[model samples]
Target: MLVHLLYASRAAHTMSGQDLVAILKQSREHNAGAGLTGLLCHSDGVFMQLLEGGRDAVNARYQRIASDPRHKDVILLSYAEIAEREFAGWTMGQVNLHRLNPGLVLKYSATSHLDPYSMSGRAMLSLFRELVSSGAIECS
Candidate 1:
């Protein structure tokens, strides 16, 4: 069955531009081979990601992510079987919150910032969908 998992985590430290690029490259390659598609948003040392694919693949990937030393306080926000993929066009779409619209951020959360911890998993997913529709996010 197809499933989608949403999770959030804090970076162990501020990531450099090169580190982010490497991460995106590796994620796109790894997810493509694993038959996963999703969106990832990062800002201010926090990461919110959604992974959609076969239940086993998604869960396995999430487990790896949870154990990765680069992330701390990993929290599984949502996980369930889904009728269809929400981010099927990309292996791993990326959104750097610095380039995102402040208004949209405020629309979802109480503040004009990316704080998935403050919003429900559904709210975070909706925000990502809106950003994609608005061309605010760049997909690999």
Candidate 2:
């Protein structure tokens, strides 16, 4: 069966642009071979990612991520069986929230800034969907 897992974590340190690029490169290459698809968002030192694939693949991937040294305070936000993939356009798409509109962020949270720890998984998923629709997602 197909499953999707959403998770959020804090970066161990400030991630530079080159670091982000390297991450995207590694994720895309690894995910494609694992038959996974997903989207990633990082802002204010937080990383939120959604992974979709077979149950085992998704679970194992999450395990690896949760144990990785680059991530700290890792938390699983959501997990569920899905008949379809919401983010299938890229092996691992990136959400460019650098230019995100404040209003869009306010619509889902108490403020204009994103704090995944303070938000519900449902709300974050909704925001992710909106990002997809608003052309805020990018792939490389």
Candidate 3:
């Protein structure tokens, strides 16, 4: 089964553009090496990432992320089995809010939307797609 996990964490220090570039550089290498796929969106001091892979691969990635010192106050927002992968095109993509239009957030987080715990693959995809096109998330 394809596993999907969404998580958030607080940045330990100010995340400058250079800092993000360095992290994305490392994440791309790691995700490619592990044969994983994901999209990460950052906003309002929170890092929200969606990872998809085999159970073991996803779990292993989570383990490593949880121990990383750069990120603290880790929180698992949601996890579940999905019929389809939402971020299949990404090896480890990142979207920072600095360049993003906050309107996307307002749209996705609309009251008519599914609750975070009950969000569907399509909903998640829409969210990621918005971030992807917003130019807010760039590759290092």
Clashes of each: 0, 0, 1
Per-model CA lDDT versus the true structure? 0.89, 0.92, 0.72
On lDDT, the leading prediction is: 2
Q: Is candidate 1 or candidate 2 better by TM-score?
A: 2
CA shift of 120, model 1, Å: 1.1
Candidate 2 clashes between residue pairs 3 or more apart in a chain or in different chains: none
Model 1 per-residue lDDT at 15: 94
- Residue 130 of model 3, lDDT score: 73
Instruction: Find the candidate with the highest TM-score and give its number.
Output: 2
Segments in model 2 whose C-alpha atoms lie over 4 Å from true places: none
Query: Which residue segments of model 1 deviate by more than 4 Å?
Result: 96-98
Question: Where is model 1 poorest over a 10-residue stretch in terms of lDDT?
Answer: 96-105
Of models 1 and 3, which has the larger lDDT?
1
lDDT of 2 by residue, 91-138 (tens): 999998775777998899999889889888888898889999999999
lDDT of 1: 0.89
lDDT of 3 by residue, 1-140 (tens): 78888776778878886876777777778888877888876554557678888878898899888899978988777688878876777788776556656466557666542243344445655777777766655554
What residue pairs clash in candidate 1, if any at all?
none
